[model samples]
Target chain A: MLFRRIYQFLIVYCIGLTCLLAIKKILVLSDYVIPGIPLILDTFGQVFRGYFFDVLNTLSVTILGQIISIIMAFAVGILGRKSSWAGSFVKVMAYNIQAYPIVALAPIIFILLGDGFISRLLIASMICYFPLLLSVLGIMASPVKDIEHFYIATGRMRWQLEVKIRAFENLSKLTTVIAGSATLAMAGTIVAEFIAANAGIGYSIRIALYQSDLARILAALFMIGIVISVYQGILETLGAQLKTKWSAPKEGELL
Target chain B: MHLECDGLKYTYPGAKAAVIDNLCFTMTAPGFNAVFGPSGVGKTSLAKLLVSRGNRQESCISTFDIDTILYSYNQERLPNWSSIGSHLNKICPIGKETLKKELIEIFKLKPLLAARFSQLSMGQQNRVNLIRYLLQEFDLLILDESLANVDEALRETIILAIKTLFPGKMFLYISHNLMEVAKFCREILILGESTKQRKNFMVRGRDYTQGYTLDKKAFDATMLEIMNAF
Candidate 1:
């Protein structure tokens, strides 16, 4: 497991590092020193401190969005399981959400809600809503034919379904959906900031652009990327731990 | 008809040759009846048909109208199937630890219930699943080639458990094990290529009187026979 994680890290790290080097080289070749490397790094640190709550506020929005989406998805999934008619509606709504880019709509949301934390939060929540719903419901609804017979012969009770049946699956599934939603919300916050607020990371990015301070802009962007990565890492670990707990112990794995 | 299927047929979505083809069978109330067939035959399919009834037969059909299924062949939406986890509460369902304890105690699913379905040694879940079904007081209990997944020792324990529970109920016991069929089932439904038929024989009575006529007609020659003593 450790090795698998490291390999995944190396693959992502190499690509990111190579792209940064190529871009840096291009800027230098064009006779743009931009700024000292140390100065860029210090600016990045400043960006982190400047909008730590911006990141938190955005994350909170993403989480709230996911929780709400799950409730909606689960309701529709259960209804679809029963009525067959509802499935088409669920599919249509899901498809419509997927087709329209939430980030593109973030500016409109900011326009409606007005500047700062609340607007960004609303934008992030809207951005995150669909994917979280789709992912959680998809896993919950998927049927495995092999295990059906067991339920038949034993006449498994209704309440018993969640424990032996649903928990293990839902744990991993919701974790993954929440992780994806977090990334979307964070990105949405940045885009929303760019359009509206002058306080958060996105606004900082705009200020750098206005001043022709390309290095500072990159620094702010890089800081946002770091926040996303760190959030993903925390979520990944949370997912794994929840999965381990939910998974029924294999006989050999038992004490 | 307590349990009857005439002109019953089923085919998978994209397969030829009906797993159950123009087959007809029936079972009376208050005892055990075993279904004997080779591995590829429609035993499991038939079991599904039976459980599909007591499970939610009314929602599917007003009565045991097997003809309703003739058109439903290869269709995704069957009349009788229930939604996923219909009984489960969507919000704040109980934890797995409690679920295992209930299944183990109530259904008699012990070590097997404690393991994940994927990690379980192949046949372990069968016993757990079977006992789960057994706990339900359905009109008919369908065991479609059910014990095929269980180990020999556990199979005996399950069979014994079923026998103990055999009061005022019927078992549609499906198996490829011909000797077990002969041993346990008094009324046997025999599925042939051209048609379906029945033969009544007791393991004790057949040897005592009929001189084991089904011995010559045994389909599973190499199947491990359940020793009558054990």
Candidate 2:
């Protein structure tokens, strides 16, 4: 029994080692070069000392834009659901917003806000807001009938439905959508910073690319990928929980 | 309080004749009143008229008398501003908490309060649908073949539960089953037997007006035989 256990452990250990090596190789290819001890130490020092505040500044704009845009989308969606005129106007506006690449929008933001966090936030919101609205509105509109009758029968006002029923029903999808849009918003921030700001990782990446600091460039990519992955994971978990909470399974049908 | 459909009439918009012609009826309040008839008659149409709908082929007609009733409605619209939940609450007047509780316990709609309207099983959704109708106050309840969606077991269960909860409401329950109607509602209106002489009859307890359509010759023979016996 002890020998068999040892054999199983060894096999597990070998598989784990192989997978780690494979991941390490992929990371390096994707610009996460793990060099010898001295080089690793130097890279860590630079990353550790890298302006953590700058990252915070970048995320602040992203969070703000995410919140504002989502709220606006919902507001307009409510209006559109009620009136064809409002809906048409909003649809046209959404299309117009879609026409301009956000790279152009970033310059406008910088010109308007003069290199502050507000400028980046505006750019992020521009990218983040529309997608958030589109996803959530579709989600909200489709599943609305039964809930409407429910609220109507209960005599709940529009406010109660919005706050209690619609919001609760949409909690999962909205969170996941926001989470995904946040990554794109983050990507937009990087470009926007590359164009205007002096601090964020985007600016550093630009500098690294210009000066052939491939090591630092790879490191930054690694960081971005890791952050985005973590966010996506979180969003996925939230969506799964919400789906389970809110939905019923099909019954008596052949699987 | 009774639900009375005064001159309830409806037709598919483009159709030549009305599906329900000059349909006027009264259901005693808080009693099970089955709308008994064969298929393709105006039994379902009568219910649809009472419930109120949107379009010609698909609409419900609710003729509310504001003088007798207290109502708040923006008439010239298609439920645009109302979310599903809000609309439900508006018509029902019982809180969402009550719906949620009943949906969970009695209907066994536990853990599915937030699901999409389309996602539920037909029977489960049927239960939910029944809940929607019961959510609001209407002295008159009109059901148009609503029980067809559920299985026999669920049908019986739902029937009993509705009977228990809505003891004070008027029901215009439409079903094809005569026996089921006898079990629930002794009062029934069987539509579509005569073109010239439409018959009106009453059924009490297990007794049913199992009447057959008679031609002029058959009627003459039957009446002449009755006259001879007298």
Candidate 2 local lDDT, residue A224: 58
Q: Write model 1 residue lDDT over A1-255, tens digit each, in one string.
A: 334444565667558656766776777633144555676567667666665665555556556655665566666555444225576577667768778887777666666877877777667666676776566456555653344333433334353463235434457666777766777767666677778875667777788788887567666655555566676777778788767655534335532
**Where does candidate 1 stray beyond 4 Å?**
A1-39, A42-48, A51-83, A144-167, A248-255, B10-17, B53-120, B194-230
Runs of candidate 2 with Cα error greater than 4 angstroms are A1-57, A153-157, A238-255, B1-31, B36-46, B53-136, B144-169, B187-230
Q: In terms of lDDT, which candidate is strongest?
A: 2
TM-score of each: 0.71, 0.61
Tell me what fraction of the real C-alpha contacts between chains A and B each candidate also makes.
Answer: 0.18, 0.04
In candidate 2 the C-alpha lDDT for residue A228 amounts to 50
In model 2, state the lDDT of residue A48. Answer: 47
- Model 2: per-residue Cα lDDT at residue A74: 80
Q: What lDDT score goes with residue B68 in model 2? A: 21
Pairs of colliding residues, candidate 1: A153-B133, A154-B131, A154-B132, A154-B133, A155-B132, A155-B133
> Weakest 10 consecutive residues, lDDT, candidate 2 chain B?
B69-78
